[model samples]
Target: MSSGGYKPVVNTVRHSITTVSKRKRSSISEPSNNHEPVVVHRPHTSLAPPGSSRKPSKSSRRRRRVRKERSSSSVDRQWVFSASNFRNLKDKLVLVSYNLLGVDNASNHMDLYYNILPQHLDWSRRKHLICKEISRYNATILCLQEVDRFDDLDSLLKNRGFQGVHKRRTGEASDGCSIFWKEKLFKLLHHEEIEFDRFGMRNNVAQLCVLEMNCEDPESKLCMQSSEQTCTSPRRLVVGNIHVLFNPKRGDIKLGQVRLLLEKAYKLSQEWGNIPVAIAGDLNSTPNSAIYDFVASADLDTRLHDRRQISGQSELDTKRSPFRNQHAVSASQTNEWSQEELQLATGGQATTHVRHQLMLNSAYAGVPGTLRTRDQCGEPLATTCHSRFQGTVDYIWHTKELVPVRVLETLPTDVLRRTGGLPSEKWGSDHLAIACELAFMGEGC
Candidate 1:
């Protein structure tokens, strides 16, 4: 582990990421097996200077690409979309997230070498391309994971009219999380890093930024309801950029990481006057995995025990059912759980002091049925496409206070199938970006 991966506190000044040599490989804490994270990608050997005269022959390049692509028969569909499902888009805030699959200077592991993706050879060009694509959305907020070069990316984003907040993993990994929002559209009120390495792992973290949104229409802002009098309150949102541990073998570690982030999120909402919240990042957990259930579902202690095993089947049912549970977890029910159950339900967990009255849901849940993918994991969306696993691992989750008005589909399945898992000719990384347009459900501007 190198000190190069560690970063400064949440700062307001815009900065660029400084490049380092291949001696630093890091990410959500490791070394003691205190946490588990899904595998990420980076270059195997040091890349040569960009302007070298030598070039591989077309045939040799093709052979290398073919070897890198592996199999694609299983990746028939990319994401679901229906042109006919029209949306009444108005007064909406668009949000997007992506995992760049970047390795810290030397963070990426896998002694068994694989062919390098498009960006592996030239990081500058990759940054330019990825930044260009991300800028096209002009989203209200953008969350990025595995950001090995934080200052560079943050400076790039700031120059594009967005201000960003970033935090590097404290432990082994150099790659961390960075979140940016339109400087003119929102004001950063408070920020901090929620560290989950309390068990001694320094890798996993959720960088929390509380932003007060600027609204043109006073009519659209939320109101403080009171028995005697009422007043208008600034509309705000809690945004988080987090990368979970990657070890698929340890579901418990994933749960612990998520719990730490969400608990902080829940607390921040209260500190920020209980504002609407939206979280985006690479969770590393699949939709059907126990970790997903721990996130998408509320009251995991009771629900999990009732099922007898850690199951994600209910998450699919809720997402598909005509009547999605829009209601928040009732306080009465939350109060019934004992302290022991709250602290050790799934063996040894943290205690979350209940949740906000508003319910949280994945923004993609609002997509019309006809426009969504039908796959084994419930949705036909595949966010991350590494050689070993290719399914959705990136997400944008929000409180019910905000409604999803529209969502952007990932790269077409055909394009993904041809490119194989990632670093395709069309997309920059293995994980495709996800975006959603959300509107305030409480008022009309």
Candidate 2:
């Protein structure tokens, strides 16, 4: 493919990586798809021209904006806030979730990205871009999927004062889930690696970690934890990272993997005095799909869904729960096999109803965003864009203990279309990174 959609920008100065930055920037425009374009109103700045000494007047700035708008429209991929609580909030943290398309996988799946330019898919070049894109966020915590190049990422992020743990997927999949955190802010208290293959959920895996805040009280300024013997640790949070299976046909396996991860996360939370929990990754399930509904609502009746179309990735199945699994099985020729699949998905409890106690909320859904970039539920219209499919499958979900202050919005579909697909010169992967600033909720509020 040609590099016709490539968009380049001036590189910014590198800053110390110890502290996460909350700065925002305007994103370049893309080729138009069938979706409507979002026009953002950029805030007027007093920044003087290159070598000019004096700041331009209001009228001149207005003229400049008019010319820029006429030349091209752009989307603001910045952190959006509903309120100013974050300004006064203490112990605030920024979390980012991304799926860095693995090098080996990318090469093996060239047919899936035939429309992408050869240079854009080059691992050597893409790796640098990936690091730079991630560095821009300076997130306090990162939940990454398809990270086969953990050593490279570790070296790059280590300079930023981040410590990470990697759990490679079982079987032949080279990519795995990795969780990285700012060492200055959080200390690793406990961690667990889960391989779903053991539970008949295939070779997918998940990573869980209990991160303890390195400070004393929430009211006091953050201080390094004392080395002396301390009976109790400070406030903490449970971080769960997973890349759910991508096979849309195996909804039963998908649900089983998610269920196991959540179960593990809940157990870890209880062991740590019920700390807040945040789960992030590429779930491979669209918003409002049966799997998504199960995660958000914490209950799902397996009998109401079809095992083959549980993730809602199939266009033929629009209803979250179209029909009873038994009826669908009986209607089809694979009655006995489908029956066992239902039991496997439901944990063989002879019950269709499944529930969880996490009470989690999606960060993007909790925060309001522009109509251009967000859906009715406030989720990015498309997190992953490629030649075959372009839709949302990545998310950052958290418990009630953490409240979303601001979220890093994704590019609009129109903007993405300009690139003809993903893994463009501007983006290192097919999926856009999603991030959010979360604050610990106060006792009363």
Candidate maximizing TM-score: 2
Question: Candidate 2, clashing residue pairs?
Answer: 30-418, 31-418
Best by lDDT: 2
Q: After best superposition, candidate 1 residue 431: deviation in angstroms?
A: 1.2
Candidate 1: minimum summed lDDT over ten consecutive residues — where?
1-10
Candidate 1 per-residue lDDT over residues 304-326, each given as its tens digit: 33221232221223234221212
Listed in order, each prediction's TM-score against the native is 0.66, 0.76
Task: List ranges where model 1 is wrong by over 4 Å.
Answer: 1-90, 105-107, 110-113, 117-121, 199-202, 216-231, 301-358, 369-380
lDDT against the true structure, per candidate, is 0.57, 0.74
Please give, for residues 1-445, the per-residue lDDT of candidate 2 as tens digits.
0011111212211111111111222333443584443344455454657777785578855544333322322333677774435556665788999999999888897765775768878878887887787778868899999999899989888988889999999999899999999887788999999998888889999999998776644333433234573625366899999999988778888888888888889999998888899999999888858888888888888767776667867443324322111212335523123655666576765677666778888887876666767766667788987766778899999998887888887876766665666687668898999998887875311
User: RMSD for each model, in Å, please?
Assistant: 16.4, 13.4
